[model samples]
Target: MLTIVKGPYLQWPTEDSMTIMWETSEQASSRADVLMAERIHSGYQGNYKKPEHVVSTVSNKGYCTIHQLTVKNLEPSTIYFYNIYSACEKGEIESGPHPLKTAVRKGEPFSFTVTSETGGYSGFDQSNGRINRNIFHQMQRYRPDLTLFVGDLVNDGQNYDDWEKYFFRPGKDFIINTPFYSCLGNHERNASWYYDFFAYDPPKNYYSFDYGDVHFICLDSTDFIKPEHYPNSAGEISSGNAQYDFLVQDLEATSAAWKIVFFHYPPYISGGYQVEELRKLSPVLEQYGVDVVFNSHTIVYERSHPIRGGQIDENDGIVYIVAGGAGAMPDWFLPKREWHTSQSLAVPHFVQVVVTSNLLELRAIDEEGRLFDALKIRKGTNGRKEFL
Candidate 1:
C-alpha cells in the first residue's frame, strides 16, 4: 500500500507563497494543486475558485519518497485550498483541499502555539499518554495558525520509531494542518532525523522569521549539550561566530513592532540543568529591546518578571517563560528565585501567544484545560511599553 508516513504539514508562509511537504512509505512521484479561496469558510471545503497544480516526478535511476512542494504567487493575507496527489504503482493516492492562510499583512494580527519538552521515553506511563491527548485536543480547538515547538519533541528524537509513536502519531490531530517550527533540544543529541523531518525558513539549525509586525529568533541550544564533540559550535554565541554574529546583527537590524526569542534553554531559569553561562544572551536581548523569551527543557511552566541585565526591570526587562510540559516528565522549582513571579509543575501544558500592533497576549493552559497564568503586554510608540 502507498501510505503517507508523516506530514502534509506546512512551513513558514510568505506574502506570495507557502510550502507543503510529506513523505510516503514507497518511492513515488508527487504533485499538489493549489486553489485560492474565493470566500472564507468555517472549515475546509471544496469551494476553491480554481485548481493550480505543481508536480514532481522521480528521475532516471532513483525513486523519491519525500516531497516538499511550494505553492506560489498568491495574494497576501488570503487563504488557499490544496490537495496532494502521489502517483504510485497501485494507484493515484490523493489527499486534501486543506485550508491554509497566507502570511498576514504587516500590521495584521496573528496567533500561534508554543510548548516544549513533551514527555519522553523515560518512564512511559499510560496515564501520561492520555494527558498528551487531552493537551493536543485543546490545541486543535484553538486552531493556531502555526506552532512553535521549542524542543524535546520526543524523549529520543533520533529514533524514528520513537518519534512515530510518541510525537507524530499522537500529534496527528494538529500536525496535519499546523506547521511546526522547532528548535533543537539536548535530548535530540544531534540527530539527523530532526533535520530531515522538518524544513526551516532559512534552512539552517538557527534562523529568524518575521510575521505580523513581529520578529522571532529561533536559536539552537543543543550546541554544547554534547561535551566530546559539539555538533553546533557556532551556537556558542559568547565567542564570535556565524550563529552568534547573526543573532546580534539580526536583533540590531530588526525594526519590527515586537521582538521575541525562543529556544530549548532559558538564559535565566531555576533547575538542576540551569547553566549560568547561557545568561550571555541577556545583555544582547536587553540591548535590542526583546520583549519576551520562551524556553523549554526543565519540564515545568515558569514565567519571570521582565528582566534586563539579570535584574527585574518591569519597565524594560524581557519576560522569560519555560513551557515544556507537553508529555515529558515534570519538575519542580529549584528554589523560590527572586525572578520567578509564577511557577507550576502541577500539570503538563502549552502556551498560546497572540500579537497585534500594540499588544502581545500570553496564555498558559495545562493538559486538563485549565488556565495556569496569563499576561497582557501592551506596547507604546516604538520603544515604550505600557506594563501590566
Candidate 2:
C-alpha cells in the first residue's frame, strides 16, 4: 500500500537546515512540500505563508524504503510547515503538514527536554509503556526546541518490534516536531538498529553539537554497565579509547557559555544501580568545565550537588543529574542518602531546561505533569555559577 511505517519525524537541526526522515512500507521515492510562516494560526481557521517544494534523497539502497531529506537555506529561528509524500505501486500517499523550527542562533534563548529508559518490557501497567504516552505529551506541552534521550531506548536493542512498541510509536507525536539527540544504554545491547534509526553526525554513537551558546556532548557509557566491569577496565571514557580522546578534544574545542554531557549509566546516584567505572569521567569533565551532566539507567531521578574532587563545591563544581524516569518501572531511593545527592526521587518524570544568555533554569516534572524539583544556575564572570 506504500504506507508510512514510521516517522515523518525531525532530526539534527541546524540554523540553516532541517532534516526530515521517514520509512515507508514499500520501496519508494519521496518528496515534501514546505511552508514557511511568520506566524501560524492555531486552528482550522487557517492563515499561513507560501509553500516550498523539496525532494527526498534516498538514504538506503535496494528498495529505498527509508528516506532522509534535508531542507536547506532555511532562515534561522524560523517556523515552517511541511508535508511528505511517497510514490510507489499503490500510487502516491501523503502525510502531515507538520510544523518544525530551525535552530536558534548563538546567544539566543532555547529550551530542551531530557529523558530516557523507556525500554521496560513488562506488562503495560508494569512497564514503561504504561506512562510513556503521558510523559511524552507532558514534554510536548513545554514545546521544547530539542529533546535529549540519555539512553536505554529499548529493553532489547536488537529487537525490532520493541523499538516500535517501546519508543517510536509512543513518542511519535512529540518526536515528529521536536528533534532529539540520543546516546546508548546497556539494554540497547550495542545493536545495529540503534545506528540505522537515529541520524546524527559521523561517529554516530558518540558525537557533539552546539545549540545557541550551549555545547552538548553525547557519549557511549553502555560498556561499563556490565556487571563485571570496574574502574579502569571498561566504558567510553574510562576505557582510554577513541571516545575518551574525542571527549577531551570536543570539550577543549568548544567555547560555549554552557556545557552539558549525556550518557547512560550514573557515575553518582543514591539508587540501587551505580557504575563505578563511569566515575572516571569526573576529572575530565571538571577539568574541561562541563557545567552539567545527564544520565539514565538507574530508573530513578537524582541530582548531585556541585561536586569537585568527591566533595561539594557550590561555587565552581560540576552538577550531575540522573533523569532516567521516562517509562521504566520506578525504583526507590536508598534510605542512606549519599553526600553528593541534592535531590532524589522515585518517579517517572522528564526534565525541561531553558537556557538564556546568562541564566539556565531546570524543572523536573512527573508523569502527571506536576513540578517536583527546580534548579536555576546563573552564570557569572569566567563561567562561575550561582545556583538558586
Best by TM-score: 2
Question: Which candidate has the top score in lDDT?
Answer: 2
Question: What does the lDDT read for residue 369 in candidate 2?
Answer: 93
Q: Write the per-residue lDDT of candidate 1 for residues 1-388, one digit (tens) a residue.
A: 8888876778878777777877778887777777654543443353444434432222222346777777777778776676877767855577776777778889999898887665442355557477667777888778887788888777777777766666777787677777678888877765888777777855457899887889899987766334443433334556476666888999989999999888886655666455555677788888899998888876767788887766777788788888776754444456556445545553578898898999999999887678878888998885777667
1-388: candidate 2 lDDT, tens digit per residue? 6788889888899998888888888888777656654445654214554444443222223347777888777788987788877887776678877888899999899999998877742332464366788889999999999999888778788988888887889999998899999898877888898888888987788999998989999988765444456334444455358788889989989999999999987889886677667778899999988889999878888999999888999988888999986754444567788898999787889999999989999999999999999999999977888999
Supply the TM-score for candidate 2: 0.92
Clashing pairs in 2: 128-327
Q: Model 2 lDDT vs. the true structure?
A: 0.82
In lDDT terms, how accurate is model 1?
0.74
Model 1 weakest lDDT span, ten residues long: 53-62
